[model samples]
Target chain A: MRAFAHTPFGALSIAILRGFVRDRAALFFAVVFPLMFLVLFGALLSNQDQSEIDMITVGDVPLLEDLPADAREAFETTFEVEESDDLDAALAEVRDGDADVVVEQKGDTLVAHYTQTEQVKAAITQSTLKAYVDGANIAASGQPARFGFAAERVEDESLTTIQFFTPGLLGWAIATSAALGAAATLQGWRQTKLLRRLQLAPVSTGTVVGARVAVTIAIALGQTAIFLGLGAATLGLKLTGSWWMSIPLVVVGTLCFMAIGLLAGAIAKSTEGAVNMANFFVLPMAFLSGSFFPLDATPPWLQRVSDVLPLKHLNEGMLDVLVRGQGPSAALVPLTILAAFAVVVTLLAARLFRWDTA
Target chain B: MTAIAAKGLTKRYGDLTAVDALDLTVAAGEFVGVLGPNGAGKTTLLEMLEGLRKPDAGEVSVLGEPAWPRNRALQPRIGVQLQASAFFERLTAREQIHTFAALYRAPGSAADEWLERVGLVAKADTRVEDLSGGQAQRLSIACALVHDPELVFLDEPTAALDPQARRNLWDLLADINDSGRTVVLTTHHMDEAETLCDRVAIVDHGRLLQHDTPAALVAAHAGGGNLEDVFLALTGREYRA
Candidate 1:
């Protein structure tokens, strides 16, 4: 006389899925916000120096000529410093995107004009010219040029900030969405007495928890696809590793965050408390895990601390596969750390879950 | 045979004991009502028997088997309607009930049948959040019964219902009882107990004061007044809210 004709897990998942899809706000945050971040960061970092700043010298700029032949050759190789005698035409070329900066010499001063909107290029050009002038004056004063260093990248291909940031953004988006989403959802279920009611059914708690975790992982997979697809399509994102390696990394990261969310739900007594607790855990991790900037920019001690966090592992592992083009084996350390965190937190969540509000 | 029997059930929360040494027995095919004021541990007691909570002390048997956490065999044999059960917010009433029904492995298309039984067939396609309180209550009841268990537990099923909705639920419960299923419900409404229950158990301060046929309890404790007077006489008039 039972009312159901099949296993409840599928039906239960379908019902729960409708809730996620119908929640327009959650959908927007889970899907659109990450892509939005990608687009915004891509636009900001698009024209950043992939190789070197391009400049044009006009009116026999002595600052450009005063360099030693080898130094001049290196400068021309590092920076596209082309010579043009016509000052007005050089300015026109700079305005028309033929050059990043236009420089001229008048008396003892070296005058430089740059595109107003190209602040990064303008700053680098100004600093480079100033350094050359300082070096020339030192050599003229009967002293070896005091300071000069050539900038070279260790990697074969130069990378933009966006390339470094995309993996972090991907990790952040998936982790926050899965963790906060699970916490809020489970707490709400407990608040409404749904968990209690669910306990009365024939299904085991493991079955229910498994269904939820599976659904979250599935959603996280979709999140990965959207971010990677959008990043590669529009942002010139290149994946050198077995790009498919990101799949396992995202899956493990999803489990890790979901387990953390389950722990939050276990501790929180109410829906609001669950959401607040999730944000409390996730927001700080997002900022510290190099989601918005390079980890190298952070203090050495702070980076060391971040290296132990799950989010940092996720971000770094993803960066290895996506940006660094390293295979899965290259990210073994971080992947193992994330897997361990997932196993530990999932065990804790199972031990502490409260089906009833009491 | 007894459908449910609890021996010296006890539950304590920190310094507060919600249910203290409570004993109860329910027979097969009977309609029983647990009557108590607010905070009388009625929910705690029912939850323990429903296997949703564990009593610090005591043993319980439902359908001749131990009823405790993870009593898998006993689960599908009982149905429960919580006071404020929430459904998936976006699921239509039918889909919500079907989801619950699916858990019990009930026959196909059971949700529509239960929705019809609860007089909610008209709202079957509506999302749970869009339903009125009464409609939602009916939907909750329908979901509880969608599995068609031999025993049913309903906690304050008619608390927020309008008079007409309350009457409809009374009729439904009476019908279920008539069909040879045991029904246990807790309520503050004495009139509901007088009209619907075959037996009423009065409780206060986490202890049972009386359990008997409603009419017999009235005749014995009412001093010639009605059943409500009997309830008031045994359980006092202090606001337990």
Candidate 2:
């Protein structure tokens, strides 16, 4: 009976992990679901930067044909211009969503007809046409163009939207599923009196809770690796910083979420209640933390709210290493914040843990 | 030597006392039965003795160590089967027993041996959630005894079993006691107390009313009927609920 003192806790943890691994639903959440999102968001966003507006020109847009070399080249590159002798046919195509816009010249005025659903494409098409027309008008007036400019990409290599979203997606996967999984697992154990039964043994509650947390962190790491591997292989994800920097970041992120889950489980009356409470926290955090979009695009007040959130730090820290190529130093602040969160929530969970079902 | 000794064991929940200043003792190798009606504090008394619960004001020693308020060192020396045993949903019967065995650091029977002893060898690989109530009860016994502890506490172990299954379990308990290990159990069945217990303790309102052999109890209080008559005479004919 006095063999290895730590064997019981380790065994209990392994047994618990085995149960989760064998559950199909758990496996789907831990592995399959995140990969599905990676594939979807990767394919959808990777092509966004390279997309062009398909336009058909009607009437004599002499401004387009007489543009300066640079302006003409820019217009050609931004739009796939197709000359149409029949204006009615071109307008029909634009209305039916087959074409993005139709450019027409009426006397001295230029008109662009576009569909509202294709607002972004239509806006870009209108701006480019206006710039070309203004340049042509200045040239026709026999005056030097007030200013000439050419678009140039600042980065050495253009970045795909997939590269921008990969790290954030990885954070989202751990923050959403791992947190919910931990809460549900703890709540289920309590509901089924498994915790009560374990209390009968000589093992301390700390050992039991620690083992479960270790399993959660392991699963989180696995989720990160799978997402990164899938993103790199399929979505052309470029790793800027040392990938090893992501390991600690993932651990810190997992601890932060797991602690929140523990707190939720401690307060929940049942397994169902725990899941509901977890969703209440995870769903909003997934959005506000910049998991799916940039927090910079959000209002300044909302960004301030997101800055204090652990997931925001996690996503931004991950983006630093995976997207921006920032080194280990970039993750220091996030790790500290997450560690603080872990300690606080863990203490609260310990205080609230109940061995009895009641 | 006394396997269990309790002095002024009192436990209360809010305003209601579950186990009042009760005192009891059981010697080594004795088969003791604790009989009580619903809400009579039988489970509470047993739990207190097993160290699963703390007494409001009392001292309990089990297996030669203080048992109340928790004694980790004594946990491995005693086996406990709660009234409602719950296990991990995904673990099989054998796996569940192995889990407890690991926790106890058992040096005795292996998980398979315990499963065989409990007559569940054929169902060892079946998931716990798929097991019937009687099968789960039997599996709980296997888990409790897997460590081969010197003292075993069984609370309503055969409460949901059929007549044959109950008889089989009774024989198993008899065999366990015959091996010279102490066994303490609580039940509402008078026949179970008469047939299995060397001494029976009857309790009501968190107090011990009587403690004696079945034949002596019947003789003194049965009015020439049986142990059931003695129980009804003491606890009354009114339903506990």
Candidate 3:
């Protein structure tokens, strides 16, 4: 038992991580790729007031004559409506910083114009128009109508996009790094006949495999740390939970992904084949696991498909803690699924793992 | 007491029979070689004996323990050097040996001495990826012997070496054998078998064709000329693959 306890899992993992860090190219892909995605997406999603038109202005309109008083009030509440002296001036406001959209009454029809990009302006106009129309209908029917849905503003505690993505990226980094590292290591060993040499020794296959997995986990943790630090510094991703929650999530993610890597290494007949297999598993998981995008808007069937991926559970667990400020107890389902994934994949890898080249 | 013994050992891979029913035995401290052609199942036989592979229909005893899924207690007592055992590319030769040594409860401090013995002392700090092929092979042997096991298995230890390196390895093997440990090696090189092995087992298509002292086999088959002719006679001039 003591001999098994000292089987180089920890040391081997550290060495593997060091080797990965030493490789600048691998480090960039493993750590920088997902971070780049986070920063790019975060900037796109940030609510900073970069554009000039934060409000829309109206001109040449009898305010409450064409629409009911209640409808007009609903419109005013929904949009920051400004009154301008002339049509040209209102259009100018639309073009300049004052208005996001200009609603000018030409005879009876309202012409909405804005310098805001089509997508942004269109979304604002659609929501405001819907509220105004609904309010008008409610006034006609003599019923009270709400203008906009109550902004369920639960304290200012929601995690930023970066915070939500950081843990997912951490999971991705660990999985890909471990899978690639273990597969490549195993292939190279097989090519050099090092595995065959070890086979002849008193060392069990389990020991060799355990060491490789340990090394992979260590490398993965290092990759995770690098990305987490970068996300915190550059993207302001925060971890609301204690280290207990974070560390175990990282460990479970590492074990599950390392198992994937071992299976790839075991099944591949050659180094090139192993590389292809690694890509086959890593690439799809990256996209489908909601690592880069939200799965909320995706179809239900797609979400079910994603549920089978180890990254999905990892990402959900991370989001639960970092994004939702929930404890591990809330993340129990994802954690359990991830643990099962780790155990199943590891057992399969061990069974399928071959030491000989053939 | 016999250090190693095999009775009707056989192994098959799907449609191909890698090793046929064969019987062999080696007394303690005897240096034996399994010499055959490229696909003669020499490796398969060695793997079976080392507990890396299970025999299809035979029994193997190594130091009074069955070889397959080897008894844990008997593991530290046996050393094996595969023809192509791999090492961590990032780990230096010394670190690799030390890591393996740490796996055992009681290990020896012969890693540095073994490195020096194999002429790899200067390259001790070199990673396995950076070492030359011959250096890597030497390091593999050093790793196997670091714990000072009583029985050693060497499989094609000198397959792709230059003449000087090969001679050096032969000398190293001779020294290892001289330390009064039993050695069972496999090779395709008849000269290696003739020069290094006290007794040689000639196998073909996984079956034992002949087994005897080098001189006795040659005298019995080649009229006392050379082991190569005896090997050619045992295994015809046909490509394996």
Candidate 4:
């Protein structure tokens, strides 16, 4: 740590950090508020299940008459099971959309015919059936498996709801805090004439802004630690492949958001106005970017809009590394897009920036 | 040596001219006050001279260097005091001055001494927000002068203060002026200008009406009247400040 006893950048950064630390509202908004969202969303969505699939049994499906009663119960919860002696009737029911899938035991193999009208339901039905069979095969051989109540693929790992929300909500928190904090702080300084005082000093605008950015990045690191720590410790957030990769992703995200904030501050006429403007943009962007909801269930138009949102890319990048078990290369496109976003906004902010109030 | 020299200074926001083509000069070691009513462009003129706001058409040289485009070399050589609200968000009186001193890379020892000089030693740990109006104003002055600049600029340091508070600030300014650093202040308070300024520049409608010693300005304009009457004589109206 550079002591406050020397250097222009050090002094300015220390003062900014101290000011932020001392401000109760900022601390709550930046750190505590996000944690609350994590606990709320994490708990609410932790046990959320995929929609049940409808299935009809037409023949002696011995796999369904499983030796383990718990695995069978698990399948029942995921698929509404029905029995039919006639194949034509079962196939007609699936075709008529009464059932999503029709499973029949033909000689030695279990065959499943599913409807295409509801693609997601059909896909889940097929996968869940396969996982049950796979788990049964392993269980018969007497290998320890935790797939007692839930169908788990023997070879592949899947993302859970808690894992998904950790980064999504955390990303939302970082974006809002960095952007709002920058806008309010800058606009406040301008209103109070602190901006002019800084202009009079030997310090350059670059130094002042750079200090602010550095401090935000530091706080972002802390946010990541606390968010991830709480998520892991209490919410059962499993740290998967290259979870450390989120470090760089978060830094870039903070930069982009801070640039947006600086631009908002420069354009707004008052501190209160800047805060309103920041929230006006950040809140809707959070939902659109899939931070609060999953994008797969959204309309095509919403997905298309999210394609251009910076937070979307940030959330995608974080999901890729933190939960999807991706490597360092997974963050490349997001890094570039966010960096470009930051540069463009920084330039725009510079154009509108005034050392004194309008 | 001339501390500040400006020529053809002008600033305009759209069709409204805030500061007309104005020229002024101040010798090194003189306490000068720019006196005017509110919105008379005194702030615009001082900001342009301080290298904070760019003039639409003008040139400002401070401490023998171009102040426009911001003379980086001359930054530490001068100080600018802002309003009390400009202090860092929740800084104590001592921390505020220390931060400013550090920005200019001045000696840390000067920060504490300034708090004492401004009579804020007992309130050194008090956050600026909690300070009384006058104490906050004094702390603002201490922040500007923490680096011991050769020249200092203050923008309405005593506005909104009680009479006793205002007098305290005036006495503080007098102490700083006694140290022989060039001081330039902008104020609508006529008595403040007349009492503390060695020379007073009366401006109205963005034009300089008079710039002279307080005694000379009073003698040359109103004859038997004070500085307020001098403004009345210049504008044919009551001086609101």
Which one wins on lDDT?
4
**Per-residue lDDT for B1-241 in model 2, tens only?**
9999999999999998989999999999999999988999998898888887889898999878999667788888888887445687688887788878888776425777878888898898998888888889999988888888899998899899999889989999999999988999999889999999999999998999899999999999998998889888889978885
Pairs that collide, model 3: A13-A215, A193-B84, A193-B85, A194-B84, A194-B85, A194-B86, A195-B86, A197-B85, B20-B206
Assess candidate 1 and give its TM-score to the true structure: 0.85
DockQ preference between candidates 1 and 4, better one: 4
DockQ of 2: 0.53
Ranking by lDDT: 4, 1, 2, 3
* Candidates 1 and 2, the one with greater lDDT: 1
* Docking quality tier of model 3: acceptable
Flag the better candidate by lDDT, 1 or 4: 4
Look at candidate 1 and give me any clashing residue pairs. Answer: A2-B106, A3-B106, A4-B105, A4-B106, A241-A325
lDDT of each: 0.85, 0.83, 0.75, 0.87
Residue B103 shift from truth in candidate 1, angstroms: 1.0
lDDT of 3 by residue, A185-297 (tens): 77777887767665555556666677676656566667667776777787766767643476677777877877787789889988778867987898799789988777887
Q: How high is each candidate's TM-score?
A: 0.85, 0.89, 0.79, 0.83
lDDT of 1 by residue, A1-358 (tens): 2322257777777777778889898888889987788788888877654467678888677767768787687677668778888889888888998788888888878888898777877887788788778777787799765566778775447457667878899899999888988898899998888887888889887788877877788889898888888778877788785767888888889989988888898899888898789878888998999888888878999998997789999998888888887876867777789999999998998899877776
Q: Clashing residue pairs, candidate 4?
A: none
Q: How would you encode candidate 3's per-residue C-alpha lDDT over B101-157 as one tens digit per residue?
A: 655433436666777788887887887778888888888888778888999988789
Candidate 2 chain B, poorest ten consecutive residues by summed lDDT: B103-112
Best by TM-score: 2
Q: Which residue runs of candidate 3 sit more than 4 Å off their true CA positions?
A: A1-26, A53-159, A185-193, A203-210, A241-244, B104-108
* TM-score rank order: 2, 1, 4, 3
